[model samples]
Target chain A: SAVISQKPSRDICQRGTSLTIQCQVDSQVTMMFWYRQQPGQSLTLIATANQGSEATYESGFVIDKFPISRPNLTFSTLTVSNMSPEDSSIYLCSVGDRGSDTQYFGPGTRLTVL
Target chain B: DQQVKQNSPSLSVQEGRISILNCDYTNSMFDYFLWYKKYPAEGPTFLISISSIKDKNEDGRFTVFLNKSAKHLSLHIVPSQPGDSAVYFCAATPGVGNEKLTFGTGTRLTIIP
Candidate 1:
């Protein structure tokens, strides 16, 4: 299992503000993913961050709204741009080893947009 | 529509007993199924997984049973402990290696001590 950590564990931001969440892994990993879990809802994939390449955004999501940076194998960041009240959700980053199918999740950043 | 569904929103069981959580999927493309446990203020942790080829997989106190025909799967925890109290989510992926996962609404399991 990978040890994953996210910075700014929780934050309350005003509407129209942006917040960037950072994810760090103990060891290098091949795939990093961003997910959002809204209140009383299931997890939804936001994007897949690849090292030194552009992130792959899932349908219903766009790059301008959620920009991602995967500069290396052990680190990545997801920024929620021009946030709104609807953006209040738990953001999580997960790391996957190329060897196995398992993906370990970070502690998650809880965002509250008011 | 949600491809994966965990109909029950919450369940409660006594300690030292068995805890069973059920999940169903509508997408036939989903080949891999997984269970994740989440605590408040924390991200979900992978608990167990079962492939379409196998009907059952076990690890220590946790066991996952799959019914491919029904597109249903279940996670069973024996001798449920208070520490087992958490929200359990069911996720499925069509293929392996960086494929997107579809998650179901979680079931909050509370183990009564």
Candidate 2:
């Protein structure tokens, strides 16, 4: 299991603002992913952050809205740009352990855009 | 379309009894299924997982049973405790290279003391 942490555990932001959430892992991981969860809804995959490469965004999500950066193996960031009320959701980062199918998650960042 | 589905919104079980949580998937391509437990204001913690090749996988008091033909799976927790009370989520992935996962709406389980 990996110990993952996210910054700005909860934040209140005004619409049109941007917030960048950081995820740091204890050890290097091959795959890092970002997910969004709405109230009383299932989690939706936002993107896959890969080191030294551009993140791959999922359908209904775009890079311009949810830009990601993975500078190193153990660190990644997801920025919610031009936030809106609809963008309010809990953002989570996860890493898949090498040689293991299990993925560990970070304490999610709860963002409320007013 | 929801690839993964947890039909039950909530479940209540007496302590020390078995608690079963069920999930179904519409996608036959999903090869890995996982269960996660979450508390309020916390990220989900991985509980257990089963591969497409296996029908049953057990760890401690938790067992995951998979029925590929029915595209269904279930998690059983025996001797349930009050501390086991939390929201359980079921997730599925197509395969290794396809890292994306489809998650089902969670089922909140309450264990009565």
Candidate 3:
């Protein structure tokens, strides 16, 4: 199993503000993904970040609201812009080893907007 | 509409007993299914997975049963332990090499000692 970590484990921000959450993995991986788990809801993918390419946003999520940066295989960042109360959720980062179906996840960053 | 569904919101089981979690999917295209366990403030950890071709997969006390024709799958934890208390999520992907998944609303499981 890969060891994954996220920065700023929890944060409280104000409305109309943006917060950036960083994810780091101990090992290099080809595919990294951002997922949001809203209150009482299932995990929803925000985007897929691959090094040296534009992140692919999932349906109902957009680049403007959740811009992702994948600078290398071991790191990525997700910025939640102009956040509202509804944006309060647990953000998670996951890494998938090439040719494997399993995705390993980092301890999530819990965010709250007031 | 959710492609994957876990109709139960919560389940309680006694330790040393069996804990069964059920899940259903509406998408016929899904070929791989997985179960993940999540603790509070922690990301989901992969539990067990069953490929569509197999009807069952087991590891230790955890076993996953898949009924492809019914679009249903289940996770059975035999001799459940207190540590097994957590939110369990069921997810599915379309096919090989595609890791993208559709997840079901999690079921909170509590194991009473």
Query: Which candidate ranks first by DockQ, i.e. highest?
Result: 1
**lDDT tens per residue, model 2, B14-54:** 99999999999999889999999999999999999999999
Off by over 4 Å in 1: none
Q: Could you give candidate 3's per-residue lDDT for residues B32-99 as a string of tens digits?
A: 99999999988999998889999999999999999999999999999999999999999999875447
Candidate 2 stretches greater than 4 Å from native:
B96-98
Q: Score the docking of each candidate (DockQ).
A: 0.73, 0.61, 0.69
- Predicted structure with the largest lDDT when compared to the true one: 1
Q: Pick out the ten consecutive residues of candidate 2 chain A with the lowest summed lDDT.
A: A96-105
TM-score for the B chain of model 1: 0.98
Candidate 2 global CA lDDT score: 0.94
Over A1-114, each residue of candidate 3 has an lDDT whose tens digit, in order, gives 889999989999999999999999998898899999999999998899979988999889988999899999999999999999999999999998767878888999999999
lDDT by residue (A5-105, candidate 1, tens digit) is 99989999999999999999999898899999999999999999989999999999999999999999999999999999999999999989665877889
